[model samples]
Target chain A: MKILLCTDGSSYTARALDLGVRVARKAASAVDILVVAKRDREEKARQMAEKAAADLETAGIPVAIHRRSGQMTEEVVLQAQAASYDLVIIGGRERRGVMRLLLGSPALRVTEHVPASVLVVKGQARDLKQVLVCSSGGPTSERTVRFAGRLARALGASVILLHVMSQLPLTKSAVLDDLEASAEELIRRGSPEGVHLGRMLDLLATEGRTGHAVIRRGLVRDEILAESREGQYDLIVIGAHITPGLNARLVEDLSAAILLTANRPVLVVR
Target chain B: MRRRQGKRLNWRKPGLALSGFLLFTLALGLMKGGAGGLTPLLRNHLEVTNAADSMGFGWLMAYLVLSGSPVAAAAVALLSASVLSYLQAFTMIAGSRLGACLVVLLIGCIYILRGHEHWTALTAGILSLLLTGSIQLAALPMGLLILGRGWLDGLSIPALEGLAAGINWGLEPLIGPLAAFLPGWALFVAGVGLVTLSFRLFDRALPQMRLERTDLGQIPRLVYRPEVMFLMGLAITLLTMSVSISVGILVPLSARGYMRRENIIPYILGANISTLADTLIAAALLGDPRAVTVVVTHIVCAAIISLLLILLAYRPYERAISNALAWIARRRNNFALFLGVIFVIPVVLILL
Candidate 1:
């Protein structure tokens, strides 16, 4: 696997490098260290790329450095798209006040526009141990499950497949039939959500990993955050919320919320 | 072959559209001609003395008919005959909407009686009614203010006069014979029947929509966002010209586990605002420019209140509604108590 690691010489970026190195070494992946800076900050950007590259090299991973000067998110997106990299890892700053609400961070913007999967390293980088994969059982869910399964296998982490049933029944029969039914009951009945979860489990097994399927009922983002905190997962995996066509940007992205609110690293599958 | 199929005109659509339009115009002419005859019944027997009484009257009338547009149209007809003040007309229109939202609930009740779970069957309808009720009640003061100030009295559509005249000319032949035999009040009743029939025809004119699970799976989750759902409700109501049709779609979707309660509140909010489109046509048909302004006031006030709810307090409002739904569904008596309160409010208002 080929991975692109972007940095800007900040302490946050340094942590991102640490996580990137660990992931590259686990997957036997080659790393391309990227530094994007303003026109006047070329020297600083090059220095940061070299430092990240030197660290990756010492870890016995093949590494190359690429330095570019332009708008940070645009440049990162271009670099990710220019090559067929499997994943792009970047550092996410802890935004506060209005910044948190606006969510204009370069890390998030790259996740939205970039062509490949993104692993946004926020807060402290830690050893990969447990991974939480959020599945909506929608059409794009298979890709998310498969990607997270592969990541878990590579990192030797335990996988928890979490499906949040946020749907409220419109009829009384539905409540009596399914809404209040627990995950085990749903699986027994072979309900759609259950079947989807079963399929996800099968995918994980194919990736040489056994995953635990857990279901919770509530708001999607809130439940995912609750599970991540309670489970103490090292990484939160979610699908890239890409809506096709002209009104693509009009829809809300749940991954964006999980990325902003989750305390640990988040991997957005594209 | 695919391009050819796409280009097919499906003449049935235009045919139905023309039939619906003709029925609507004929219904309006009949109602206008018969409206003057109902003043005695409205004044002495019904005693619709004030705005509140008329509001209750409209509300109760909608309950009897299982629809709101006809009641709203009747309010405009009364206003055209000078039997109701503009404020009365506005409040009556508002009241019709509050009562109209219950049609979905009633549909849910039928499902419940068929051996479905009571709570799930009724929650969507209950939520829809609650959302509509809150926004309409909040819009009341502002709507009354707008009509009371006479700010929109001069807001006339010049084309309405010409349009009404042409329709009157076309409809006179069929209406003349009925007018000769029927008393004024009876003519009004017949006109209302015609109005109801016209709406049914219009409903038939709309394209049939069925949301399969496969289609829903492809829909992005963001489509459930408050703003997007708001626009969807608005657009669908605008097309269907009936809140009953728009909100009614929620029942089957939710029952099948295709839609969520969280996603529907904003949709109901949006549906409430544009559901006034049919009443606006009724006002224009009345040919009293002030009648149009009356309906417009209700529409504008509803739009503002709904927008505020969506913008300022959507998350909180959604939570509050969810809580209310749970509370109502916790026991059978609570739901019964809710029904009793809703039923009694209109009676009390009419008495007031």
Candidate 2:
């Protein structure tokens, strides 16, 4: 796995870089740090990239730093498109007033336009144990679940697969029975036929998927975040309708609700 | 700096040319009306049954269709006023009334810039008209020549006859009472006033209306893919056809309104007359009659209205007529918006 770590020299970015290096070290993947800057200052941008590369190298994580200049969103998107980076990591900052009013922060624009998966590290909340994955009946949800399961397995953590069904006259018996059957089928069909269903199945399989089968009926973003907090998940994995670029800001993506409100790491898969 | 100065100079020349053109067109119109003894000729012409002289109505209809679009219509009117000064003299009376709205728009722009330097505001106003007018002039002749005289001849004759028939059906009952009580000019003035008032109200309100500019700069993230345009186009076509058919059925009922069937002829004729404002303004500046005639005939067609209605109906629900056009042109071409504006705005303005 090749991970792309995006930083802006902010403290939050530094934390994201540290987390990215750790993840890369564990996954045995090479780490590429992309520093996107405005076009007018090339020397400062290059110096920043060199310093970041040196810092990452000291951590024993193989690092390649790329310095890009232009409108941050376009530069990041262009690089992401050219490189076969499996994941993109970026830092999020709380925006307000005129900064928020004009062009939304670069991270938001990148999230809106990029095609690659994004991981937005918020602040100091680094240790990810309990993982939450919002599942729809679609293929994106299935891919998200499988990805979350792999990460959870690596961390020796528990996985929560949340399916928020907004439609209801929720008779508990019928709803529970339907959920059980769908969860069993998802596990059975989502994995290989010959592979043991026992490994994929949750401890509460008779009830539904592992962790919790949350059926809170509301907006998709609100329900996902509510479940994340209530269920005490450290990391939330959501399917994105868009990809993230180097300078892509968080506010642009609706899915960035997880990063903005949840105070947890958001792993967005496209 | 040098390039900027050159551009400024280039801009200034067009501005001067445009002001001169507008003044010339207005002067020519006044002169034609004066030369012909406006009251006698207008009254005589109104009373005469030109049913046998199909050419006169045909010419009117031809001019109407050609002037349906702003660029073409204005040029044609200007050309007619300059070369066929005799015919244009009468045409300008009606054309000027309709074209006066654009003059108002230009004037409004001036007022908007009132706080700025006088010379700068004047320069900007002239520059805007010149740039816009040049584009209209260039586009008009091409549109007319492509459509050709034969096709226009057929369209105008039928459209004029249809309009006349529609009006006669509507006005036959009221004509006697109206003739006895109201003068012709009274009705004309009332109609013109209503149009002008509606336009004023609309202009005042439109600025407050908000429209979203959906950024489709990234192709991969587009919610509605390229295939959606075809689907949307088909849906719009079906809806427009249905509405048109329904309107046709209700024409008799609609005749009861103040805008009787005969009004349809003038309504359509007024659209032709109004559309000529832009082109006429352009031609007056260029002093080109052939180009103006060609443009005017093409724009005045019934097809222009049909096309405009079709486009307006298809404009997306969330979008204004302008934004929907921008979205539709996202992948195809930028010129689509300009073409759409030429077709859509005049019809909307005239019908409203």
Candidate 3:
């Protein structure tokens, strides 16, 4: 497997480099460290890339240094697309209060716009001890579970797969009486949440990564945030998007909320 | 030779039923006014001089009948017949609404007995009570103030003039023969039966929801936006013309895991306000401008209170109700306490 790691010469960027090195060394994957900078800061960007590459090389892992100039998110996105990389790891830029509201951090933007999976490394935890993954059993859940498993296998980490259900479910009258609805048996079933957790556990087992499953009933965002804080897990993984439908829009997107509020690193896998 | 079978709209199925429903409603209205031979006893014993007492009296009356519309009709009849003052009549309507909320909860009790958990079985019914209680309670003071000021009283009933005349003219022929054949008390009993039949007809005309277990199971877990639920509640109540029916629809949905905690309150609020349409008809039938004023006060008060809560304090209100519900659902003893409280409140009010 090949991985693309993006840095902007920031503290979070350094953490991303650490994660990439550790992951690549365990999985025997090649790492390409890319430093995205403006025209004036190209020299600074290249130096950061060279340092990341040297660090990976010392671990006896294959590595390359790439330097680019332009918008940080756009350059990283372009480079990942241009190369055949299995995963893209980036660092979250922390800003306070109004600055965050007006100017979104680069890492959030990359996760929002990227078609491929992007991990926004948040904390400085290096041992890769624990990971928490949240799922709603949407279409993207299988991919999210599979990717989290791969990460666990590479880092020798334990996984916690969580699925949050509403304590009080809401009912809406259907437009057509489903009783009058005519179709095969396949069309009759609903998207049960347990189906997602089961698939995730099965996928993780295939990768030889063992994990415990948590079924929480409450507000999705609140339960996820509370669990992450209480567990103090090293990393949090969630789907970047749900299977888009009118039903999907009813609740606030759990992924977006967790990524913003989670103190630990959040990997918004697509 | 082939025999030809003739058909014309098959009035027996839909049309005859519709006409019978209308006739039943007409009969029920006449029966409502005449049936109150017991009205004098109730008024004197209840001592309902003001809004508070009237609300208490109306609530008890609705509980006795197990229906809001009949109590609302009784309120209007009392107002028209000089049995209750305008203030007493208006407050009685409010009380009837509060009492009407218990009907769904009573149905929920049946579900609970049949082996469903108290949480799923009673959530819809309890939500109906809570939303109705909150909005109606909020509107009580506003309704009193509005009626006291005579601000809305000046609104004309010109549009209803034609409707009032047509209803009386059509029902007058049927009333004479029925009155001569039936005693006064019999008229009220027959009216209650006909009213029940009319509601049954309405229920029959509605397209079947007929949700399978799969759909029923899914809806309980799904949640909708407050505004969406509010509109849905209003629309369904308008179609069914009864809050009990709308709430009963939620029971199966809740049991199957289709209801959300947040979706129910707003929907109940919508259904509560819309359910007053029956009283509106009752007010028109009375043909007293003051009767119209009383009903309007009920509507305006409920609307103001519900709108305010939906816009401003919905989250806190939702949380408070939900937390309480969760507390009850988590324990068997608490559920019994809740049932006792709901059952006894009206009984205590009736006695006092």
Q: Determine the iRMS, in angstroms, of model 2.
A: 27.9
The per-prediction tally of clashing pairs is 6, 34, 10
The single-chain TM-score for chain B of candidate 2 is 0.32
TM-scores of all models? Answer: 0.81, 0.36, 0.76
Write down the lDDT of every candidate, Cα atoms only. 0.79, 0.43, 0.69
Name the fnat for model 2: 0.00
Q: Write the per-residue lDDT of candidate 2 for residues A139-232, one digit (tens) a residue.
A: 3555566666655665666776666432211111112222223444535554221122333343224323355444443334556777877877
Which structure among the candidates has the greatest TM-score? Answer: 1
| TM-score order of candidates, top first | 1, 3, 2
Weakest ten-residue segment in model 2 chain B by summed lDDT = B254-263
Q: lDDT for model 1, on a 0 to 1 scale?
A: 0.79
Q: For residues B1-352, what per-residue lDDT tens digits would candidate 3 score against the true structure?
A: 1223233434334764566457554754566556555455555765555556777878876777788877787677667666677887887888888888777667667665766443555655666676777677678778778888888885437666467667777787887777777776567666656665666676666654543343223345444556666776777787677887775566565443344455666777888888877667667755777887888888777877777777787767776766676677667788788777866776665565
The sequence of per-residue lDDT tens digits that candidate 1 reaches over residues A1-270 is: 789988766667778877887898887469888887665656666777786677777878889888776666687899998887889998846667677668666767888878899999986679879999998876678899898888889989999999886665554445445666676677888887778888888999998899888887656777799999899889999998866754454455788879877889999999
Report the lDDT tens digits of candidate 1 across residue range B16-42: 677877777777767777888888787
DockQ of each: 0.28, 0.02, 0.22
**Number of the top-ranking candidate, with DockQ as the measure:** 1
